[model samples]
Target: MAIDSDYTVNSGVTTGVIGMQDPLYLAPGDISGLNPVASPFNDKHYLKWSRAVKMALISMNKVGFITGKYPKPAEIAATYQDWIKADYNVMCWILHSMIPEISESLLYVQSSKQLWDEIKDRYNQANAPFLYQLRKDVMHTIQENNQSVVNYFGKLTSV
Candidate 1:
């Protein structure tokens, strides 16, 4: 009988990897953050291969926008470099706070009307009461949530 091969067992193997004297077991993710989890196979060796793969993918893009040459099939994976993904989700909220993510290149490309439109849309999104709501997004959503800030501001501004 032909010996049975386990496809799951060999998923971690890659060609052209140097200094891989020890097999990769713990993926980069399973070992990241405060409390880490271990994968069954590579637990005794090192970082989880799955998490490592994800980190490599994350590094290939900014806000998931990739802008680089594709590597040849044989390149060894590199460590992912990125800000927390949640930061991208909070873009509008942050920009509404008079913070923007515009870089020098993007700033010069806009026409005056485009700039005004951007400004108007951002500040005029909600009425005065709702405008105050976003300031508390981080705090309220995280702990001790409330809509009281809106009422207080509404009373003060009377609008």
Candidate 2:
């Protein structure tokens, strides 16, 4: 099931919308001009908006509404950075957890050890395990796993 399907949910059907708790940045009401608690996300709405947003997100390749590199007020950043970080952290943790499974499933497993070693070689003195660097390392690991992902990104953003 592709998740974009016509079957009823959780009824042994092959497909339906992706289920809840996606932790999307845009809540249901954010798009429909309603309070976050009033519509879409609301039970009265039966999570219709939530499901719709999930479909939207699945179809939306790149969200343009977000400012790519815009400066933001500290208070605003502080208010929401935790949510973003936590959401991202959980997602990363899940993907990282699946690394071994995916590697086993595929014939060739692109190892992150080489990529990490190269990075460590580049910055010999900065060997401290830092959060920011760890994030980069994770990204490197993911890119190593999916050569096509790296190729696509590099293709689109060539220097």
Off by over 4 Å in 1: 1-109, 127-155
**lDDT of candidate 2 at residue 117, scale 0 to 100:** 31
Best by lDDT: 2
TM-score for candidate 2, residues paired by index: 0.17
User: lDDT per residue, candidate 1, 1-159, as tens digits?
Assistant: 111111122467532221221111223442222211122222221223324323543442211211112111122232111112222222222122221343222244222223323443443344555546645553344212464876656544432
- Alpha carbon deviation, residue 64, candidate 2 (Å): 6.9
Worst 10 residues of 2 by lDDT: 61-70
What's the TM-score of each model vs. the native? 0.18, 0.17
Q: What's the CA error at residue 38 for candidate 1, in Å?
A: 52
> Which 10 consecutive residues of model 1 have the lowest summed lDDT?
65-74
Error of 2 at 14 (Å): 43
Clashing pairs in 2: none
lDDT of 2 by residue, 1-159 (tens): 121222343655343232343232333433322222222222122234334433443443212112121122244332245234323332232223223443234223222223223323433343345546656655564344547976857744421
**Candidate 1, residue 73: how far the Cα is off, in Å:** 52
**Candidate 2 Cα deviation (angstroms), residue 46:** 37
